[model samples]
Target: MSVSNSPNSIPCLLLAAGRGERMRPLTDELPKPLLTIKNKSLLAWHLEALSAADVENVVINHAWLGNKIEEALGNGSQFDLNITYSPEISALETAGGIRKALPLLNPSDYFLVINGDVFSPNLPLQGLLDQVSALRSMPNQPLAHLLMVPNPNQHPEGDFYLKDSKVTNEPLDGAEKLTFSGIGLYHQELFKDLELNVPSKLAPLLRVAMAKNRVSGEKYAGPWHDVGTPQRLQELNAAHE
Candidate 1:
C-alpha cells in the first residue's frame, strides 16, 4: 500500500516501555498494548491511525512482555508500515525511552509520539502539521507542539495550562485546566540538549522549552480514552463495543 504524500508523513515513536502497573493482572499475561479492546490490541488501533495519517515508519520501544509484542506485530509490514523496535533491558521512562529511540526517528522533521495505553479517535494530523509549519516559519520559535485535552474524570486536577495555544507548567489557579492528551508533535531539536542515555522525564523538557514560550498546543475536543486501569479498560471495551 502506497502511503499518501503529505508533509506530515513523519515517523512515529510509540512509547510502550511502561510496566503497566495500573493494569496489573491483565498485564501479567500480556503487555498493555497487546490487551484486547473491541477485538483489537491497543497498539493495533494506534498503528491503524498512524497508517491512515500517512505515517509510514514507527519506532516501538518495549520492555515488559516485550517479546510478545514483537512476536505479534513483527516488522509492521502486515499493516504496510515499517517498524523498528527499541528494546530496553528495563522500562525507561517516557523521555528516556524517546531518547533511546532517537536514532530510529528522523532527526529532520517533526514526529508524532503517543502513549501506548491511551486511545483517541483519528488525530488531527494536518492541523498539527500546519502548527509545525507555522512555527518553523518563525525565527527562534517553538520546537514542540502538544495536543491538549479537557481534564478527564481520572485526572480532575489536569496536567498543563493552555493559554493562547501555548502550554505551561504552571498550575492553573481557579481557572480551566487541561490535560496533556498524551499525544504530541515534536521536533528533533527538542532533545538536542539531553546527552545520550540520560534518564529524564518529558515534563522537565517541556518546562524549559515552555518557559521560553517555545511550546505550542492545540485543544482536542474529540473521543479520547485513557485505558490505564482494568476498570477503565472494561469501560473502554463496553463503550467502543
Candidate 2:
C-alpha cells in the first residue's frame, strides 16, 4: 500500500465555514480558521503541510469572513498548490458543505478532509492516504476512514467505538471508544444522497455508514488540539512562543 509522495493524486478539502461562537471577539472579524497560532493562521499550517505532501489542488468552503480567507490564500500559488473556494451565504454544516463542493471534487472517488480549527502537527496523512489507495481496489469500499483520538476533557464521553479498525456506533464490551478528530478520508459516495444547499451534519451520515460496516478508523495518539475557545488558542500560541 505505497502511495506517491506527491499528494496531487488526492485532493484535500479544508472545512472552514464554521461560525466560531465560542471564539467570540477573536472571530468577530475573522473566521476561526484564520485565527493564528505561532503567528501563522491555522489554515496556513494545513496549506503548508498539504503543499509539502505535494497535494496539487485544495478546495476550501467558507462562510464567516469567507472573503478574508480568499484574500489571505488566493490561488495558493505561493504555497505551491491551486486553491478553489466554495462560498456559502450561511454556514452549511459539514455534510452540506461537502455536498456543495462535490462538483469541484468530482472525478476522484475519495478526498482528504480536515477541520480548519484543529491543530494536529502529527496528523498521519501518509497512512490515511495509503489506506485510501488500497481501498480503491476493494469491491465494497468504505465510505470513510476516520482518524480518531483520545477524548478531550470537554468531550470525555467519546463518539464511536473502534474495533479491529472498523467504526461502530454501538459500544463493544472491550473496544476502545474515541472522539472524531475532525480529520478523515471520505469517499464521494458517502454524500451522494445528500440534498443540495441544505444544512446537514456529518455524524448522522457516518452513523448510517457505521451500521453497514462501511467505515474504518485508526486511533491517533499525538499532539492534537481542538482550538475551541480563546484561552486555549492563547495557551497554544504562548506554548509555541
RMSD of each: 1.9, 2.7
- Against the true structure, candidate 1 reaches a TM-score of 0.93
Model 1 lDDT, residue 43, Cα? 91
RMSD of 1: 1.9
lDDT of 2 by residue, 80-149 (tens): 8888999999988999999998887663789989999999875657667778767776777999999999
lDDT of 2: 0.89
Question: How many Å off is the CA of 32 in candidate 1?
Answer: 0.8
TM-scores for the candidates: 0.93, 0.95
Give the top-scoring candidate (lDDT).
2
Distance (Å) between predicted and true CA of 152, model 1?
A: 0.8
Off by over 4 Å in 1: 171-175
Could you tell me the lDDT of residue 106 within candidate 2?
A: 63
